[model samples]
Target chain A: MLRTVLTAAIALAPMAASAAEVVSAVLRIERERPAPISRLELPAGDEGFMGALLATRDNETTGGFLGHTYVLHKAAALPEDATAALDDLIEQGARFIVTLAEADDLLALADHAAGRDVLLLNVSAPDDRLRGVDCRANVLHATPSRRMLADGLAQYLLWKRWDRWALVHGSHPRDREKAEALRAAARRFGARIVSELAFEDTGGARRSDTGHVLVQRQIPGLMQGLREHDVVVVADESQVFGVHMPYRGWTARPVAGDAGLRATAWHPAHEGFGATQLQRRFEALAGRRMTDLDYEAWVALRAVSEAVTRTDTADLATVLAHLLSDDFELAAFKGMPLSFRPWSRQLRQAVILGDGFTVVSISPQEEFLHQRTRLDTLGVDEAESACPL
Target chain B: MRGFLAGAVALLALGPVAAWAQVVFVTNEKGNSVTRIDVATLEVIDTVPVGQRPRGITISNDGRQLFVAASDDDTVQVFDPETMRLIHTLPSGPDPEQFVLHPSGNPLFIANEDDNLVTVVDVVTRRALAEIPVGIEPEGMGISPDGRVLVNTSETTNMAHFIDTETFKIFHNTLVDSRPRVAEFTRDGSLLFVSAEIGGTVSVIDPASGEIVHTIRFAVPGVTPEALQPVGVRVTADGSRVFVALGPANRVAVVDGRTFEVKNYLLVGQRVWQLAFTPDERYLFTTNGNSNDVSVIDVAAERVIKSIPVGDQPWGVVVSPN
Candidate 1:
């Protein structure tokens, strides 16, 4: 009789099986690059712009605990397919989408993921607009915001007593946003921008075809009438002319912008609390040191793991509620805990100032440090966020 | 006069002239300081600042010099053991992480991780005599009993590369696990132990054949692999007991040397990295790198009888030869 009853129950178990907890994720690599290129110094896929996104998936899921099995789906993106690709990810049962793209791609993904119970995690792109007026509820930024990066630079500048600055801007939207963010931070921290200069896109190689002749022709006049400033802050996020600006075009003063004192989510030498272990593991598995994009994606996956463990469920609503709540704190490789902005849902974090191989310092060196809590210093704080739930 | 000279030599051979094991050298990783402790009175003698990020330390065979590998500075610093003064600095090639002295006391072999090479430095000349390529991320180093072979463990390749000291060539590479950090051979040359920080186990390999003979697994439920990391392992002189330091687990596992079984565990401070033994083998000292304290264990009782606070991030420790 018991066997007959068990067989009947097993036959009627479709509804319960469907309700069993499961989480689906989509890893989207929205990058535009030529065929993968190899520099002699690095590996085959090391130098390509697209490889940064492809390498991100290498850090996603491990240990396989909490009944969570993540599925990653890859999509190659040009500049145009940002919106439709993110929508396709949501339709394919991905409650979370991690993207490696720029400001325009993030804006499109933010709209697509909004109100859909799907979180769009941006691993690349450091435009302040995404964390400011353009911030959204469904979008969760894994990378440190542009404002945080600027703040970090400003703190070091203030510490070094570089109280005067000359701001230079480039043609791209990324450059404009970075300059504006730096300007706002300087205004708040009492560092004055003495002068401003703008560089044309020129549309070709990074270096001037005319070379030193062109730089000698243009820079003296642009910087001719300037007063004594401590440093020159150049915003060339497009990498078009940031390298050219240093030691060649600019004046004799030291530059502290994209080229000299860069602010980013991660650096190889930022050996803080868990960074050594994470970096060691990343190097072991990925066969190379981790970059900023890879680090952000890893943190996004960690946030997912933490939420799943805390909520004890993979259901979209439950996980979203926990992530939005104030009690969430993520212990990342940054040596400090991170949390979310209640309004914008951007994860608050510090940006490390990088000089290529080494990290010079972290922002908010404990003075301009303003926070509703420590996590609020990353992006727009809870009290000031304009994002609507 | 001849009889008096022989008597004085006998007295000198019998013991130290005075009680001179007063200061223990505690190597600091981040603070860049070497703490000195008076073990007899349990007082911190002095915290002397040193070169950047010193990790491993070894007292000279004569006990007159202490060599510390300041990794960040890429040099080995020599200090007067009696005066505690920075007497001399020796270039250890690029990124020297650990060092092991030759038994004959003529040269020092350094494991340079950044260059992936082991540098043999002439003690008197203080110059690198030879550089031999090893595995990737070469860290812990040990010399064989016969002093003819040296073993260096690479963390990334997870292998023990045996270097022939005479030829300065890699004899063999024995793969152990995910991240093998350190390797040490038993005094009798019977067993070689390699610690895999990520693998959560130490592998015992036979030096002659480069074969893993035994695997010792360490684990505690609910604690992650990051916590149960086994870093430093030292065997007693009589080969009766083996002590292994578990990184964040904050405990040292005392294993039965003959049976290869864990006998008991002694709780220590946090993030235990390097450990040492008194020359008499009666007490074991562990440098708790995170807690800034050195835990002194009574080996016979298998308990940490005392904890002495030291410099910031106390890392490596070595007993004085005298």
Candidate 2:
């Protein structure tokens, strides 16, 4: 079926926006991933692309009325072949690309697209540098920065008056960065890390059987004699041990960070702000629960949709300009309208703190005030932004 | 003889309840209770417990039955207004957020947020007459004054579905701003006003052609643009003034009915959301969620006359006619 469509497009040769065709793409670079602590956390094959697909349909609902149709090209590649895939999409005349990749590959692609009339949206990278010192004008990010997620969890913990933290981190680079973000949040929120430990990844089965007697016994012994803390904050971005530490804490305190109370962009069980229907619609299309990556990708594409719907044209430059402008605010089902920041080009949105089943709270926790919008309190504020653009 | 004369005088004091032109009922979402206030005295009459997470409260046109959407309970509980007792339950699909009654007073069209369908229930038979599939997260049900058309606005879908009353089928859909919370029609049913909560604008649509005639925007000096979310909308019976409850902005915008211009914004309690007017149209009561109170606005003067404290998280308010 895809071959037939491509051939038909080739036969038509000189495709133009005058045909009411709006073209975009999703370029995903698949890197080797460490498994999560449970089998239930396994990812579907089309995790992020499925979200873009749903968004194309939603865009068409409004775009069809305006005499425009949306088309999304999906491509996935391994780390080594990522740039080739990106080039393939660019050759197909896709100017707007939503990328699902880690920091290194994503930045490489952005650099490769330089001076090519291309704009890339990062939907999965949590590296602060991508939005901070390494920020680019042609790139916009919808994913929450590591500090934003850490601060969202930190605010909820502080609001509960749980000021003392038992900080535990895995011995990986990404995990260390997550740990650093957590430490930054603790200092920013007036909390103290009373105890700290680094758990070395000894290379065992990642999806460990919880009922195994030996693993159960080894877990509780780690935090046995720690100093008294109100909560156990774990930073295990490599999926080493955070999920396993939830119910096995020594002091019977609650766990947060990448475990029990993780901060995210969207949650499946989140029913607030008409999200129940959104959740249902995605389930109908994808036949699965909408993951955080799916939601970020969906938001990125919808930004283009909102721009196209408003401008009533399929012109990529016009739509891209509106997407990055102050006049553009899309109702993103986050209890508010969302827009990109002028300095860093990051999507400003609220973070959802959930426990996998239900939403615990949303952050920027009413008391934390900003002279601007309260959402600025979660991540890098404008005054503190390191981005030159 | 003195005892009998005093008892007769007590009957006169009770007679004021019947002579009252209207009374107020506020639904407290968190408190799970309904508060009734006397219009004559502007005092609390009684507070009665209802179903879980009670919202979208209203009285019948003839003022006999009061309907409340117990959203969490997934049912619409009908009650007797005078006695404050639950009469029966209508088979509301699921999570009935808001609903509108037909002018003939037989069927009520309800917006079921969870099911993505609108359940039409017969008030007299207490049965679901039809379930019409609509856009996702259906809310804001508004019927025409002549009872020919029913409009249901879905928040996530951002479309106003126009359903024919006779066929109980969706005939046309008109796209509006995001997160539309209320759909209101003018008394003559010529124009429809739909308020978008997150979009912070009201799209005035011509129901006949399903075309948007004007889009009204609101701004206050001290409030941020992002904070100005328009929720509940009410147009006066005379169609001269349109009042919109601005969610989180804590102000109600009074608009010119014909020009669709924002005339003024009257400050009220915190998170002022839903609104209801007295039968005489002299007073408008707004349910303030955060402040746990209701702000009574003098319609003619465009001023908040009083703030009466109610239960926790007051969500919806309605007044029974005389």
Candidate 3:
């Protein structure tokens, strides 16, 4: 979606000098092996990698005039140990890397790249720990933390006067973490959690015809004993049971969290603040709807690209310094210019609340006030973040 | 043809009185009406219901017609300014947020926000001439002083597409700040100022070179940067000062055109969306969406002299050519 025009300074430069002066920056995308199949339907394209490719194209549109050449190297289907692949990319002069890996794998890569001037951008994992006590100096996160997602949704629910929530979560580690964050958000936002229940993912084929019958019987039973609540918040990151609880809940309350009205980093239905142009461009490029992972990956790469284009250099130290500075701001069509939190390195962005068809609203509601930036209202602020860096 | 002839006759009938009295039209999005303000007396002279969600508005080059982009209705309703009557409706593409008329007075270029297309319509015939594909969320439209190059600022793409008027081809694209909502060409057409609502900066771009020469940032004490969203831009005829409507900040920043430094911040009403100037350039009027009012500023005094109440959510404003 990026269009560029050669600057007068660059256009007037001697052809020979310009040819020799192009600065090259290689971006590496490191992805671990696919996790075990859950109920989540996989996108047709490689989510994170496809996003990086689109970003590469977008960056190249303006990169040439700045004497910059961007190269993308994707490492996918890596074995359990991706140390060798990381080393190979580093050897190939890739100081910037976008990792579509889990927290443990990302930490391992950070350890491997320590003291090597390598900056890793986390675009997949939303682990709160990465932005908390386990934060790394060289790692920046584009993905919203689970706490951020929970707070975003809570802000909207509170705005709508839906203060009481029935919490239902699946039996998964991430699901537990998401539920914990939601509980924290409820406490912070003055909302009451009426009841809590855990839905164990009993092993079964999800698409079976009889599975619908079982879900219809099981979901209502799970909701039967819950106290009166204005909304049902489902925390099923494993995607096992959340989608089924929407209309099938015993009480006809609105559903939120992982299904029904959901809070996400990006949604195809978002058209406000000119997101329609981004959606159209992404559709033209990828031939599919842009997913949250794609948007995260694009933001990560764009951060690096913005840094390089502004600084007019490919030096890792300079780019990293500029990125961490207050002057660095990336406009990502989120109704606000996105910046990194120096403490958590989490990109501050607007969380979109959307159904499948249309965006219901955006978080950081008008009522959620912050002293510095309203975007700080959605996630951990510098004053409250546990990260020492 | 009939509408134009009737408008001409109406103009002839009100000739001397209308010439002396300048009127400003403000479109209220929520009220679905246009509020007319008399410049000499600074009063709400009339309120005419137009269509649904009327936002973008402008006067025809001849001063006889007013075009209002009723976004919800997806039509540009033209009205006779003198008689205050709806004349015709042109087929504007979906979600027409903003548009500009070509200097020749025949074609109207509109930014179709939902469809990512700039639709060109012959205002006289009310026939769509062409639909030029641009970037996402085209919201702001600007034409060069000579009327050769048309500028469309795409909100999402954050780029100003300089399209050739004759061919309707995008000759050059200059990337600006995020969520650009308005584009205004200096009177001389030497420079183009694009206001980025989210970025809170005004990018001054050179039209011929297609380069962003300077970026002007705003900072008001006690106002958060997030609330300093720049939505509307206006440059003086002499290009001495530039005024930017800071959306939620409830102020208009006046910057020195030569130095690009903020000279003064004139306090207005809440959520100021757009501005217009009197014919003699003695006064300026701002449409405040949240306050449902318009603030009148004396150009020489550089201060708001009066705040006149208008329809609900008054968004766009335009002054009659006469």
Candidate 4:
């Protein structure tokens, strides 16, 4: 009798349903990373999973009003144990999964989960190819691509009248990819790349007692013969020497890109646009600060929750359909109602530019405009679609 | 000479009432003080130190006392409106961010953002009467004009829990947009307005049916849709107009009460968070968080007459009743 009234009332509008139901999702994560050179940068053993934990509680808050309970499972696995983890979750009846894996692994998982009535929400992988040439229809991305971050930083630098850049990239593949993205950003934003140089990895003990002493001399030596530039943009995603280039620049120009005033999806120091309260809530829940990966994982589950709430159903197919529709918007406290780019399925958000402590700016800096959304000015636009899906 | 001296003394005695008819108080969440502004002069007259992180503020119907939610201190500090002296404090639950006074003016419902309950305190008894479980992160509190129903909006729950004033039990839950910051009812008790900050829309519900009657969306010419977040809401006594504070968009949307059509957008200070109106409804004051100032809107003309500088992080505002 109550079900009939609820159905009728739901048909009229989205009245709070009185029927008991459970909505479950899984965070399929690859939890292996290179050892951090600094203790300050070490993982807390609950990086992405903690975000899912907090977001599950948050989802449960809204779900409780309508007789819905949200449960999230964290399926963390190492690199070699990926397929087994994926199979385990599938056997456990996981239909909605927010995956935090590397690009190739993510693609493999997407291929594995395809046609199984399962959808993957990518939370951490920043590879543009995942959203570009290798784009999968079943996978949606919550994290911004590397191009988005580079473009976001470039816009802010140009807005600050620092249009001339001296680029320095590491020897690693990830660093090269980031440097290439920076090149794309420069071309798009009309910034001049005065000089481009690559620093060799020459792998050694990154955390020696003489680490800073060697870095202080080597960084200046690298910056010695650089052309006259307004800022030094470093692409060191591996975090080898990015931290050393800020104060050790040959000229006293400001450092940017992956170091100094860097662009990121989320930062612990951000307090604007009601983010302080959010940070406080996170701190209260996790007993630590939030990171970009945690925030992206949180966004993934939240994206799923938004669809579930709007559709008033936990059916994975309906939720995914609703999410892919134009009516979907995620209010993730970035002073915007973030939506997915139709061509790439990448979640559009403001890139926060900060110096590790203060949020200097959020970009697509007011000058660079897009036809649809200013957020589109940062990443891949629909007209340039390399993504066939 | 003796007649002139006597006449001067009599005029001076009536000076405050004749000139400064009303007092407007604003709570500063960062400055840990409340700034009092003389409504007639549109100037800050005094800043009285209060507890830490004061946010929600209200005044008594008779205009005798003022109440402020000292959120970080976990207490609601009450003060004499005229003297600016501490009257007493009612025990607020942990992290009381916002609260609403009962229309009959006894029980106060304080929404505890940390705890998932609405703490009800009786002003006369100065003790908590009941802790009503509503939803998670409850912040906005609204009571019907006829004093039969109370509405509390949970920020995370994304619903307005309607509770019976007599029994203090949640009778119905009306789903709204994300991060609903304020819930307000029309003076006639016919319509309810719940402002969602992140969703950027105001859902107007019918009190009797508990169904949304209208949804008001705001748009400014150059402003991005994302920046237009609705937080604080105020409806006129005659139910002719509605004023909504658009957070970060820094504008107040004026809507026609009858037609629910947006009439105009009045641009105010930066990051506008809350709103309050003078007793006569002639002037509306808004607390701008980023700018640390208050913008006074002349309601009849629908224009900002003055931007009065206040303390740091001004969050809530309330004007004297009389």
| Local distance difference test scores for all models | 0.70, 0.85, 0.82, 0.84
Choose the strongest candidate by TM-score.
4
Q: Extract clashing residue pairs from model 1.
A: A152-A363
- Model 4 stretches astray by more than 4 angstroms: A1-32, B1-20
What digit string (tens of lDDT, one per residue) describes model 2 on residues A204-283?
A: 67654545566668778999977999999999989887888877766689999989999999899997766766787899
Ranking by TM-score: 4, 2, 3, 1
Candidate 3 collision pairs: A277-B136
Using lDDT, give the best candidate's number.
Answer: 2
Per-residue lDDT for B171 in model 2?
66
Clashing pairs in 2: none
**Could you tell me the TM-score of candidate 1?**
0.57
Candidate 3, residue B128: the lDDT equals 83
Greater-DockQ candidate between 2 and 3: 3
Ranking by DockQ: 4, 3, 2, 1
The candidate with the higher DockQ, 1 or 3, is: 3
**Winner on TM-score (1 vs 4):** 4
lDDT digits (tens) for residues A313-333 of candidate 4: 878778878888888877776
- In the range A60-88, model 3's lDDT, one tens digit per residue, is 64454334577888775353557777787
Superposed Cα deviation of residue B213, candidate 4 (Å): 1.2
A best-first ranking of the candidates according to their lDDT comes to 2, 4, 3, 1
lDDT of candidate 2 over B218-258, digit per residue (tens): 98986777779999899999899999999789999999999
Compared with the real two-chain complex, what DockQ does model 2 have? 0.16
Compose the digit string of candidate 1's lDDT tens values, residues B1-322: 2432443465577686654554578898877988876666656667778999888898887788899999888799999876668989886886787789988886898888765567788878777777766644578898887898888886543568777777776657675654566788888988888887756678988899878888988755444434567889998877788899987788898888777787777789998888888777778889897788999998888989899988788888987864
Candidate 1 has a DockQ of 0.03
